[model samples]
Target: MDERKLPSPCVVVLVGPGAAGKSTWAGERFAGELVVSSDRLRALVGAGEDDLAASADAFDLLEAVVRQRIGRRLTTVIDTLGLDRERRLRWLALAREHGMPCVAVAFDTPAAECRRRNRERVKRIPADALAAQLTTWNRVKKELPGEGFDEVLQAATEVRVVPEAFVQADAAVRREDAAPRGLRFGLQVSSYTHKGGRKTTGEWIRQVGARAEAAGFDAIYVMDHFRQIPQVGRAWEDFLESWTTLAYLAACTERVRLGTLVTGITYRNVAHLGKIVATLDVLSGGRAVCGVGLGWFEAEHKAYGWEFPSTAERYALLEDALQVLPVLWGAGNKGFSGKVLEVPDTTCYPRPLQDNVPLLVGGSGPRTLRLAARYADAANVFGDVTRVREKAEYLKAQPRQIELTHLSTTLIGRDQREVDALVNQLRPRNQDPARYAATANAGTITDQVGRFRALAEAGAAEVMFSLPNLDDDLSPLDTAGEVISAFR
Candidate 1:
């Protein structure tokens, strides 16, 4: 086959049983394109020719070169014996990460022919090595596409290529069937310690809960912290325990689900926290979501006299909290003992209404992703659609089903002049007025309708908007009502 005429956006992997003339054929076939050879890299690095000691360095250099060339839209050929799944996956990830297509070409020449050709070589491999190589080759070929290859090619002189487009198409079908079809929305009603003398009183919470439910929001989320963020104001203004306020909201709002945007697992024991969430979930008729995270605010810990561990230790506690919560909520009531936490067998009353109330974790980190995979029902990310999509892809690899909810600031106006007024009012909170002004005052109601529809298409299960303040006179409830009415 002419290498230049090969498929575009594809990774063509050359594979075969040991001594099956893979390297010889690849050298002859793709002489024009960049050829990444393990042997040449060892030779350049001063390791004995073809010595495995330099294999790691050789592959590293090979990867860098291939990535650079492929990034420039050049077709590159890898000339190593691509016999195992792990080796092939490196190339597969390179292709996927760059959004290019991939193809694997395996040499299926007969073993007798392979051995006959090997006898003609100057440095011959051992028979046992060839046998083991053949065994791996057979096992990996069947597992290639599952390992993320886009196409698989089997050849014994004449090549046979199996298109993975059907698999991708089937995946699309399954996604459509399994995806949440209902309209879902959430709101952030952060409890603020009033500016100078005002308090975050029970009345304010009731008003916000009423507004959220009246505006047709699906859920009401409160911020979690011991003290108010200093950037907003002083620490002693009026801060309330997030869970305690959530309990109040649970009784006040019958329709809108109430929960924290995220609660720190640092201060509370995991088993006790699980019991609290379970009680709230049962009281609220399964309308409570437990949003947990590793504590971040150091000042809050100092203010509240709670011990703040190192980040690594906090992550361990976070993981322990996630593991123990399920056991506490489910049949396995035996206490959990981990490096960070120990819970004795003690049953709590009023198990959650839903067999499993949703566990929502907030943050964008590798450990967070793994935890979400193991325990989270959803992840709360604060960013644009592109960033949300990236997080979603990472979360998809985890074992749990994770929905993504993105938090953004929204300003709605009845007309252009009202929009301008709202933008001015919000200028103090935003870092860059011009950028936020564009997002807020981009166009008419028709434009915002289109924007929200696009967000839904981009895979956001819910988009929670952060309002300025209750007394700010710019109601997010009104804005949400308008958007929901227009879209629905």
Candidate 2:
């Protein structure tokens, strides 16, 4: 089989019962290819032809060769008898971990035919060994696809092996595991403020955080901004910095993870920002996600005297910042040189508790989506199912693991009157009153739950409900709890 004909980034596993001629077929068909054969490795290592110990060592060597070759984008053909589902699954796991496609080629020839072929060979296997191999083969054949083989090729007999298309048969095994399963929920505390009689936001923050955790929310996110919007209240209103609040929340909460709904890359140096998040993660015991976005709100930027550039310039800076952040988090005293910002050997202490901190980017724009596709661990969008589905489809086109998260305002009420009143209070804030009215009034609890369900089914990995107010009465908090409970 010509390696060029197979998938570019893929690992093909040839599986079958004893005497199925997998080795012979691969050897003859895959000449000049990087073939990983346990038999060949065992012989080279001076492991006796029939020594089990030597075979194990040989398998390890074969795996190492396959890994090295695959890393270089070379097509590799495994010529061993992969008759155990677990053994085959290990290969699939490797493929997934390396972000490579994988396939399985199964040879399902009859027991009598396999025995005949084995008898013809000078170095024939014992009859008992062949029978055991056949039994294991039958079991794995039924289980391979479920175990994560993206493609499966069936060769019932030698006649079925067309070298030209046999390789393509294995290409069918490139299936990915179904998108992560479960009801995932996130919380966005946007209304929290310390203005107009309110002094500090910490009290409300702790309250909201506690409520969200008690309600079984998956994550609690705060808005990243230095000042309150004038439309909401006074311009000089007291506001808490997002990351500092999150650090406080990290120490206060246990079950719920903490992060910013959207952080501005322009506010702080990227490397410093990464180290701060890493420290928060360590403080939180690994319950931290870094949600970021290209900074907007020119007024706030002006007030702080932060470098607020044109939209394109900010995005360019954001892109550079995102790239530098990971390096600072992972590498000690490492400096980054980019078009926007450059640091000379600056080290940030205490890396994040998580192995790879979740990097979330929030924006519905195409540029943001592309950035998410290229760099983010997840993307956050605020829209209905239709909008979300469209964005998800766009993100899916990229060859990366980028989860989508949808954000929406949620108001739950037991009675229609209460629901109507809440909707009226929310109506003034909506840019589109009609749309808000329709969504709020058009659904029952079940109907709303179904809407969220549709969002999830349409590829939303998680949904976050932005609360109407961060009040101590906790009315919205209670309502959100009921809605979340009903959904669960």
lDDT scores in order: 0.67, 0.72
lDDT of 2: 0.72
Q: TM-score of the candidate numbered 2?
A: 0.59
The sequence of per-residue lDDT tens digits that candidate 2 reaches over residues 380-451 is 997766688999999898998689998776655554445545555666673333245444332224334545
Compared with the true structure, what per-residue lDDT tens digits does model 1 show for residues 1-488? 41122333345677767677766766655433446766677777756655767878887887787778667544566767787566678777887777766777777777777778777778776778777877777776677657656556655443211112111222333343456244577777654543333543666677778878888788988778777776444676566788888899998889888788789888787777888898889888788888998878898898778888999999988888877787788865576788778888847667787787788888887788778778778887765556777887877766667787776655565654555466666665733343345443322233344445545555668777666544534275776677665444
The clash count of every prediction, one per candidate, is: 5, 8
Model 2, total clashes: 8
Q: Assess every candidate by TM-score.
A: 0.59, 0.59
Off by over 4 Å in 1: 1-181, 193-200, 230-234, 429-432, 435-448, 472-474
